[model samples]
Target: MHVLIVGAGMSGVGTGVIAAAAGHTVTLVDRRPTVGGLWSPGGHYPLARLQETADTYRFPGHPFPSSVRDLPTAAELAEYVRSHAARGGLTEAHFRLSTDVRALRRVPPEEGGGWTATLVPVGGGGGGKEQLRADWVVVASGRESGPPTPMPPVKGLDSFRGRILSDRDTFGMGADELLAAAGVARPLDTTKAAAVPDAVGSTFNSGGASGDPPPPSPNSVVIVGYGKTAMDLAMTLSDGGATAHVVASRRHWRMPSTFFGFISSLPVLYSRAATVVMPSWAATTPAARALAGSLWPLSLAIRWLIVAIAYVSVLGRRDLTGPVPTAALDWFRQSFCMIPDGFRRRLAARRIVVHAPDGVATVAGPTSVRLTSGVVLPTTALLWCRGAEHRAGLSFLPAADVEALFAAGDGVRLYRHTVHPDVPRLAFVSAYNTFGFGTAVHLQATWLTEVWAGQLVLPPAAAQRAEVARVGAFKRDILSCNREPASVIMDRFYSFFDELCGDLSVEPVRVGGVAGWLRPLSPDWYAGVGAEARRASLGVTV
Candidate 1:
């Protein structure tokens, strides 16, 4: 079996490793010169910006260097992946490096079945575009693009005098070029700047230099977005001694890096406690949805319980993390911040300005921005950290195929965010946002592999479609008032994991009875579960 995996990032490479190990010939294609798509040039650079501990964030078969016991630098992780790909049976021939999968179309059985994908050379070399066909196709192109799909321009953006930067535009430039672009005066001594490895003199990127923003921080930049990237930008700026402001239409939920002071948020996010039925489950049908809104109490209680654990996590800990937040406890339950930095402290100290509910109206001038709340802000760089919509930015698929898959803004019409029942011979890895994404993708790729290899079988198409609808209804019926998308907040990981385990005839990672209930809550706990899944998926000796 020949499998063509797209995007060559963590998701793509992870899938390729497992699939190739299964003895199916696999090809990993990415537009970037390196592995780890989002971390590569196309997305964010200076990979050191991420907050996850490297040991937990990596793929199963590979581990970071022993010296990097804690969080490894971005460059280190990127280097590790390059090494991982080179080490496996996945040789240079297994990769079509620096290539763009321009278009994809399914080959009808009448015309010799399989899928046809068009590839275009992206880098320095000039070569005629080519088409490749494969029995199985995996679109793991996990958001590997520029500045997260440009947002609606601010009213006077074109006339802005100072530099406006995006994630790519900021880190993509060299040290001096970046400083000049952001209109910041260069340090008289070029030693610090010249020695900057990945955006800073120190590879760790600690903002220890004398009153200097790390290489990525723009002087007095205004970031627009409240997601993790926005937090990172703010932290980088604060560390670099730059003034940063955040603009948002609504205040997003913010989580403490540690729920109960010492425990990382990963444990809570992927815990069994979070594996509850969502309110949107009611969205499946009008009649049932009428009662969905009434389930608000249950959702509220769930959110409260999570928050309780958060406060309890830090109950007796030293206040070194930051000032305790007394407001917006609800936001903590909506999303995990994952940033173990002093962002909240910086916010309180006015080092980082947060403009929520007073979103940006547009660029007011070359050196200032105006807000919808009738306030104007002075700044040189306007960094748009806005998020991207998955289906809208999916240009690789033919227009017809995209409409068929993502019509009605319902996102991909895939069951469990993997296989699109309506679309055969295709699967998407890392489509869903979850704390345990790596483990989930591993399971998803295996399910597809087992199904394809005749070791397992998919349910009837109707059953698959019904499952999709059922989940959609669950999301819509979640009896919560948070107004966040119903798709979030619930953890269905074990449900899918168990199903796939049964499909492969492997012992599922079940926390049977009471004691089992407490397990699988910590992020690292998945290591054991993932080991079992990997054992089943790859037939590993472990």
Candidate 2:
């Protein structure tokens, strides 16, 4: 089978390598010069919270140097993923680096049973967009592919002399472009394989990370949003001795880097067992009726147990809870902040002031921002780390084909977040899910490969959509508590993993058997996970 996989980052490469090893003809396309979409040294370097071992974040067999720190640096991660991609069964000939996927159109299976993809070379268009055919198309673009939403062009007097920074400016290509834009002589790519052009923080002073070249650091920074990127920027600025103030939209549940002081929260927050507590049939079937009504008492009991465990486990930071609704809880993370390294100390020391449950009301002056609280804070650099818009990633498809691809407005309404109901032979990797990023993408990639290869079969399109819609409703209800709906992450990774493994007649990761089930989901147990997934692909015994 001929397969076209988009994005050379972790998801794309992971999907491509395994599928290619399975004898599927695969082509991995990346617009960037190197791999590691988020971790790439040449792109926006948001710090992915990996409280677990580096093994949790990597593909099976492909891992960071064991000597790398528990909290590996971005350069370390980028290099690790790049080296792994370079070593995969899929060779350099299979990868089209520095290339962008312009659009995708699926050929009716009746016609030829494949999709026609359009590719455009990014920088120099000498390649002129050659069309290619593939039996399957996998969008491994991971999340955060789109450009960050531009900060509201405020009534700022443009005369205010300060660096106008956004996440793109702080952690993305715009960071490199800033130096070039200022005629600061953007650092040349000195190291070919080591230096990532888009992700290189060298000379950018984006942060004093790993002793890279030092770009000028901001003196005072007012950050927007509190996601991974915002926290990273805050840390970088504070490290540089800058006064960092975060204009947080809502207070959120924050856990120490460790869960309950010593427990690794990665397993709990995204692991298979911790993710899906409901019975398998309850998700999309009549069994769910008892979830709210007949089992209302049980539901309350379960919610109480989960919430109480969390409160006790994380030692219950009061800022995360109700009354007036301060910082909101992490919807998918189940209120586990998992942020370590003295974030609380920073808050207490007054170095970082979180003006939360209140957003930036307006840009008061050229160098100041008026909060919804009417407290005006001076700003040297205003960096918005708020997320990017959700893209369907099917913009390249023909309009009619695109219409069938979506049941939810602009989102991919695919079964298991992989194959669409109406659109056969198409799958997506790397949407935000409550699972280890590596494991989640690995499951989807291999499972879809198996499904396409006839090793497993999926449910009917209508049945799949029914379950998806129910889960979507569950996501809405979960976020309705905080009034933010669209982005709620349900703990569906392991549930779906179990289902896919069942279809393929393979064993899911056995959380119960590991360390007497004390740490079932820890990435350390992931050493054998890939072999199991591949075994499922081959219908081999464990």
Candidate 3:
């Protein structure tokens, strides 16, 4: 089987590796001159960490190095992936860098039942244009590479005397150029500026002898939106001694990585316990409703007490590994999973004010933002951290294929979140958005590959459609159960893993208490078991 993968970042590279390992000929194409996708410098968040567990985060068949811990930086990840590819004996011939896939069409299959794709390379010493046939095409292009959202036209924005800048331009320029562009004086010396922490130094900085502060315009920076990026920017500014004000459209539910020295222990425990104790049947019962009503206040009280204890213990602690305790897995079950109220209070007290129930109208100027509340904030700069949109380079796909594949209700229609119903041969790997480290992509890719190889057969079309409806309904129920948005990756990771292991009829293994004791070690064992079981179940010769 010949496969074409678009975008060489982690998603693309992972897809290529897995597909090629399955004995399929793979061709990886990307617009960049490199293979790391967003892992490359200038394409990713500078301080981002892998938000999920390490076992779920690692590449297939590669052992994680001993020296690494916590979340790795983008550069480290890039190196890790590059090493994996090299060790696999995958080389330049398997990857076409600086090639852009202009369009996708279904040419009749020359060999068998599957379809073929015509790939057009864009740039680089004029490879001109060549047509290549493939049994499958995987769109692994990442979320961040799409075109930037246009800035809303703000009234009187152009009239501002101060400089304006976009996030992209901020990333592009050197520190000196950035400062000059902002009409701010560059730091004159190392001592004072170095002493002052929390400042994000961009491209412009020159070593100097005399100590002098950069000229201060207005010391206030008004940031729009309050997602993860906004939170990071605000934290950075606060560390740097800048007065940062955040205006949010809605109040966000923040979950700390750890609480009272335990990482996700309490939330994990509560979720599992709820599932075990209150089965779906009982949840809908009238008696259950009465019981829930009577116990609701008590539940809230218990949660608060656990959080209060954890908060008091972590205050003024300096351990960056996190103060959360993980010795007992059930410790995760005791505490509230979201950011403790104590932390929110601390942030509020420190002038990191939240202007929720209101959103930005437009930028009045470099020094002001007009709000929807009819109030104008006097500000120095604006940082927008709104969210991202799913945009596949649609120009490359045929109109019929696009209509069939993309969802009518929400812009993308995925069948079982893998193969397109109309274009069955073209499967997308990393199209779905998850909170952290492309877990869904890896899981979906594995399943798609297995299905294509005839190792795992889907139920009949009628049964498959019914299963999709059931899964979709389950997702909706989970979404309602938790106030947070229904994350495809978070909601489906375990279930997908279970299905891949040929155990869809069984419930997911709950990891709490005794199971929690099994966690740190269990993931590895589970992977091994899953792999062997899948191979055996599919009758694949491995």
lDDT of 1 at 500: 54
lDDT-superior candidate, 1 or 2: 1
Clashes of 2: 17
List CA RMSD, all candidates: 8.1, 8.4, 8.9
In order, how many clashes per candidate?
26, 17, 21
Candidate 1, lDDT over the whole model: 0.59
TM match of model 3 to true structure: 0.72
The 10 consecutive residues of candidate 3 with the worst lDDT sum are 200-209
Candidate 2, which segments miss by more than 4 Å at Cα? 46-52, 61-63, 108-111, 150-162, 172-218, 259-336, 392-394, 399-411, 479-492, 509-516, 522-542
TM-score of each: 0.78, 0.78, 0.72
Per-residue CA lDDT of model 1 for 59-151, tens digit only, reads: 544567888745565566667667766765577788898898888888989987778999899964779789998998898876434225556
Expressed as tens digits, the lDDT of each residue in 1-542 for candidate 3 is 88888788878887777777778898988877776776665555434445444444666456557676645656667777777677666899998877877767676655464444555555446657767677778878854556544556667767655545454444433434434444434342224323443311221111111222233325455666655555554544443444456666543334455554555543442232222222121233233344347765554454445444554434422111122343112222211223322234324333344555466676665576777765566665665655443444555777777765543323343555565545667777766544224445555666767776776666555554555455445544533322222224342344344344442221234244655423332233333433553545664421
Segments in model 3 whose C-alpha atoms lie over 4 Å from true places: 52-56, 60-63, 109-126, 150-219, 236-242, 261-353, 362-366, 392-394, 435-442, 460-466, 469-487, 503-513, 516-523, 529-531, 539-542
Which of the two candidates, 2 or 3, achieves a greater TM-score against the reference?
Answer: 2
